[model samples]
Target: MSTTTETLKSQWEALKAENPHMRIRNAAEKLGVSEAELVATSIGEGVTRLRPEFAAILTEVEKLSKVMALTRNDECVHERKGVYLNPDFSSPHAGLFVGEDIDLRIFLSAWDKAYAVVEKGEDRDKKSLQFFGKDGLAIHKIYTTRDSNDAAFDVIVEQFKSDNQSNEETTVAVPLDIDEKPDSEIDVDGFKAAWIDLKDTHEFFGMLRKFGVTRTQALRLAPSEEHAHKIEKDAIVKMLEGAAAQKLPIMCFVGNRGNIQIHTGLVRKTMWHNNWFNVMDPDFNLHLDMDKIAQTWIVRKPTEDGVVTAIEVFNEMGEIIVQFFGKRKPGIPELTEWRELVASL
Candidate 1:
């Protein structure tokens, strides 16, 4: 190893000795390096660097059986427990995981660094596969549960292990821009006309790109109050409570640049603690930074079934933190209770 890398490794070790509970992400920040770099230091010690063949790795992930899939951004963290199955990698840059319990939209381009980590616990070793973006931020992670196939995990880890095991310092580029356009410059008339002509909810992203406006900007200039109305910041908590009370099944979508993790079911427990709103359940957990939510909107989109409504929350950066929708299939109409619940907000 080079002198600088050796020094970083030593510093990381010393920091771990000082506080063994310090997370690797926090430790990387403390040492002024990327989390990938910090993890690379322990390549041979319970950690193995994997080749950046994300699709193949995901295919192999199916063998691990039951595991927890985790995806997070700066303001939201989503975790779901299930098996990884039916991964469609037809597009090199984009992929899909269409499992009943674990649903994910994968953007493979953002995923650059991959690693298989084996952490020693009090009783046994905890194994995981972690993926990072070009900026060295975590994109997605899969953790092996107690019921996971340990033999399958070991085989895949050994198969995909990288030959180059050097503990070298690495540099990361600045995060990608969101391609946002100023609201003042956007042609409001054209944007409104296109918004009104929308046929499917999936076309929303293309509409934004066509009008050169950000999602938040489109919400602001949505032509009519019925189409998009601003809501109280605490509306999320209200919606969650309402869902729980009515026993309404809902879909929660939380994602970063590289992946979108979804939880579709009934959320029984809604919790608030330390300025965070959380959905704490047995199979899924959602942690949202309530303080970071600068705006909340009730957005209506026309689908073939009917006009579907959603509760969309945005962070201070105008990026979506989390979105909530009434659980309904593509052919089914929106639930009347859900619409009423959102309207009550």
Candidate 2:
């Protein structure tokens, strides 16, 4: 090991000894390094580096049977327990795992580093496959549950293990500075027309791109009050509580730069832990830091079936923390109860 790596490893060990319960992500932030770098320090210990063949590795994930799929941004964490099925990698830039319980939208281009990790647990070893973005932050993670196929997990580890097992520090990319165009320059009339004429929710991104306006900016400049309007951030909590109380099946989406994990079902238990609001359900869990939310918008988009409504939450950085929509697929109109619930907010 190089002098620098040895120094980092020593520092990491000292930190862990001092704060054994600290998560590696927090430890990395404290040590002024990437989480991937900290995990790399244990390359030959409990961590095995995996090749960047993310799509292929994901294709083999189904063999492990039931696992927990986790995706998070800075403000929210989404976890869903399900089988990895229906692997689709036809697109070079992206992929999808369209299972009923665990649904994911994967962006292959953002995937950079991967590792197969095992940690000693109370009863047995905890196993997981973690993938990271170019920024050295985790994009997605799959953890083996008690019912998971341990033998299949071992097979996958051996199959895609990287030839290089060096504990090299991960490279962190410089944060991108994407400045949104001034709203004054946008064609308000044209943008509103396009938004009104939208047929699918998926076309929303294209409309934003066409107008060169950011998500929050578009919300602020919504042509009509019915189209979009700001609401109190606390509405998120109320929404969850209302959904749980009414047994309303809702869709919650949380994602970062690389992946978006969706949970389309009922949210049963809702509670608060410190500043974080949580949805503690059997098959799905969501931890959202309420303090990070800066703005909440009730956005309505026109669709062929009817108008679709969504509760979109954003952080101070103008990044989406989480989005809630009525559990409905294409060709279906928005649920009246959901629309009423959002309108009540």
Which candidate comes out best when scored by TM-score? 2
How many clashes in each structure? 0, 0
Candidate 1 clashing pairs? none
Q: Tell me the tens digit of each residue's lDDT in model 2 across 263-325.
A: 999999999999999999988999999888999999999889899999999988798889999
TM-score of each: 0.95, 0.97
Tens-digit per-residue lDDT, 121-179, candidate 1: 89878999999987788899999999899899999888888887777736678665667
Q: Lowest lDDT 10-mer window, candidate 1?
A: 169-178
